[model samples]
Every structure is written in C-alpha cells, then in structure tokens.
Target: MEPVSPDRVSDAPDDRFDQSVEALIFASDVPLRDEDVARAIGEVTGADTTLEDIVAAVERLNAAYRATGRAFRVEQWGGGYRLATIPEQAGVVRALFEQEAEKRLSRSLLETLAVIAYKQPVTKPEIEHVRGVGADYALRQLMERGFVDVVGRADAIGRPLLYGTTDRFLDQFGLGDLSDLPTPREVEEILADPRFSRERAQLLAEWAADNQPPPPPADSSEPVGTRLRVVVSSDSPPTPSEADDADG
Candidate 1:
C-alpha cells in the first residue's frame, strides 16, 4: 500500500472542500467546531483536513454568500460554527415567528430563567430566594424545555443542585454567548416597558415581602389592657409624673 503524500492532500480542490464544509454546516442543528468540521471532511474524503483548511473553506463560503446577498450566513458562535440568519433579515424573521413567540414562556418562567441565566451555577433555593417564590415548577418547566440544566452541585449545605443555562438557551434567544446577554441599561429599559412593568412590580413586591422582618411576637406575658394602653400614643406630651410612673 502506498502512503498518502502531503502533496496529494493539498491537491484536493478548494471548491470541493468548501462544498463539503457547507454541507456539514447546513446539516448540523448545533454549532460545528473547526476541528469537528475538519474531522468530518477527512472521514468522508479520506484526506488529512486541517483546522486551517476548514477555516479557509468557511471563509470562502461566507464570502460567496455575501457576494450573492444571501439571507443567511455561517457564523462562529459559542466556540463553534453555525448557520444563522443575517442581522438585516432579523425584522422579517421575527415577524414570521411572531405568532409562535406569543406561545412562549410566561412571565413567571421568564423571570425564573433570567435569574438562572444571570446567576448561573446557582441552586434552586437561591433562585427561589431571588424570585421570592417556589421555583420547583418553573425549574422543571425550563428543564423540560431544554433551556436550563443541572450543571452540578453547590458547595453549601446539602450540596444542592446547581443549575445553568444550556446551549439550547443561547440558540433559542439568538445569543452567541452569555456575554451577549442584555446589559444593565438594556435590562432596565426592558423592565421599564409598559408590558413588563407589572411583572417587574410583582417581582419587586414579592422580594420585598420575603425580605421584610416578621412582626414582633405578641407580648403574651403582659396584661392585655396594659399592653393596649401602652401601644396607643397620645398627642399630648406625657407629664413628668406620667413619665415617672411609666418608667417605674
């Protein structure tokens, strides 16, 4: 058997490489890493395809798409390459999905998801504490929807399960990574919107209610009549004799 030569590997036509890479990218539901693309091409073509080759092929494919004004392009996101609609087409794309968007997660689910996304590797108790409500149902719903996942256990007592946003979450929201999440100002703007203000108010109210200290326990030992009299504050200033009697 003859050993494959480097020259023979380089002889593979660039267009063929580009086409192979394009096919893989188009077929993949998730992002394909450069190395993964190269490996797939090598397996199919029986050639040593390097990462550099895959990168060059992807560049050429994107260049062609730009020249032809394609509605979509392959982009590197979350450390992998995936096909996505170009930014210019976002308006129409969003309009097309408007009906489906209406059926999306409820405000409560979104609030729970926001807590998990921003404070990842967080536990359910921490999530509940932040939202001031039980998160069992929300967390289960998120997990079922393939957005949030149990990444690991926290170090605190019970080593409670720690949850984080999944890659699917990024894809669903058109985010490249966690860094692409809205900034503080953007979040404020979203909260300020009339549609979301009510939900925001509810969250704040819940948090406030949860953090408020419980009322002081009733003075069981004190006489009820005396307690009632002492609890009432009079407009008239207490006389010296009255103050002395109270102190006594």
Candidate 2:
C-alpha cells in the first residue's frame, strides 16, 4: 500500500485512541499485529478492544499524520503494523543504509528465497530441480538470516525436510502475507507493460524462459545432481579447485 500523502488527507480530530496506538507502534521493536495492539490497549484501559477498532484507530492516526505533514506513517506489513518513512524521506534514509549495501543477499540467494516463498513446504531437491543448481549454501544463508525455516518434512518418499518462509521474510520484503506476493501472471503483466524498457524486459524474459532444468540423459527420474551440471556462482558452494586454493 502507498503511504498517505500530506495533501490528500484533511485534518482529523486529535484523540486519545490515536495517541495510544501511535505510541505503541512507534515504541515497538517489531511490527505489532492488530490483536497485539488491541490487547495492549485493552490492558491499559480495562476495556474490550476489537480488531476493527484497532484498524480504524491506525487509519485515523495516519490521517492525522498526513494532515500534519509528518515524514513517516504507520504501515501495515507482515500481517502487522510498523512505522515507515514516507518516500519523500527516502534520500536521507537511504544514505543511512548505503554503507551496508555490500552485505546484501546475492542474486542466487534471492532466487532460492523466491522459490521457497512461492512454493513453501517444498524440499531441497524440489528447489534444486527448479533452479538447476545446489541450494544447500543458499538455504543455510537464508536460515542464518532468519528468513527461512524448516517447517516440517515432505510426506513423500524418505520424508525429506520441507522448507518454508518465516515472518522475517514477509517483513524484509514489506509484504503483509504470502497472498501479497506477485503471481506469475502479475510478472508477465509487468514484463508486458508499455512503460517497461525493451532491453531489460528481454533479459528477464530470456532468463525466465531459459531457467528450465535440462532433460535427463536417461529417465526423468534420474537424480537431480546427475541430470544437471553444478554451478559455482558468487553465492553457490565453492568448487574443489577453489576450496583447495582457499586451504593453501
């Protein structure tokens, strides 16, 4: 959802409810779900707080912020509420994060993360099959980053462990939930948009088209490792030659 604009909203009456909600969200170390907000408010006032009340209260708070030209707004993300600086504040806010840019996740890890997020409860082999590359290193990195988790085991043969996205993943991407993720149809629509650049559009299109795993030399049931050549990208596990050099 887009942040509220200062020019778009009229002045709202200042009220205690908006104040309490604002204070709670602003003070939170993490996003607070509506129920969490309601419970916290109810505990303070000794009154029943409903989910609808909490939602409306936040909307009113944002309206007040818009009318007052506040640089930030209370945003709903990861199925919860958190304060975020408006786009107009991006210049200075971005400067604060620029130095840490090199620490960002690599493309391979992002691709693996995307697969897991879209097809959660999927197994390592399944992820490997989709990407035509090893996912062990990427999975480990994602786990360490708190974005992925071992949800359970696949009910298939050998009961391979199943992986799924964590709430941290939703928060990192500013998604309210899995349902907010863009579908394949949406991606195609984006690629087809008239405003899209032709060159980059073709690159993405080619990548998507060529991402299919190679056919098995024998049967499709052959092991994924045998069916595809291993790649050593910036994020993939090191090859034997590279590992040997590192040891030396």
| Backbone clashes, each candidate | 0, 0
lDDT of 1 by residue, 111-192 (tens): 9999999999899989999989999999999999999999999889888999999988887777778998886568777767
TM-score of each: 0.58, 0.69
Instruction: For candidate 1, list the clashing residue pairs, or say none.
Output: none
Clashing pairs for predicted structure model 2, backbone only: none
The residue ranges of model 2 lying beyond 4 angstroms of the native Cα positions read 1-14, 94-104, 186-197, 200-248
lDDT of 1: 0.79
Highest-lDDT candidate:
2
Error of 2 at 23 (Å): 1.2
How would you encode candidate 2's per-residue C-alpha lDDT over 1-248 as one tens digit per residue?
23444453234533577778889999997988988888888898887778777777788778768878999888888789999999888778878878644357799999999999999989999999999999999999999999999999988989999999999889888898899897766878877877676565566556544664676678466665422343323244567897899789
Give the C-alpha miss distance for residue 188 in model 1, angstroms.
Answer: 9.9
Badly placed stretches (over 4 Å) of model 1 are 1-13, 44-56, 77-79, 85-103, 183-248
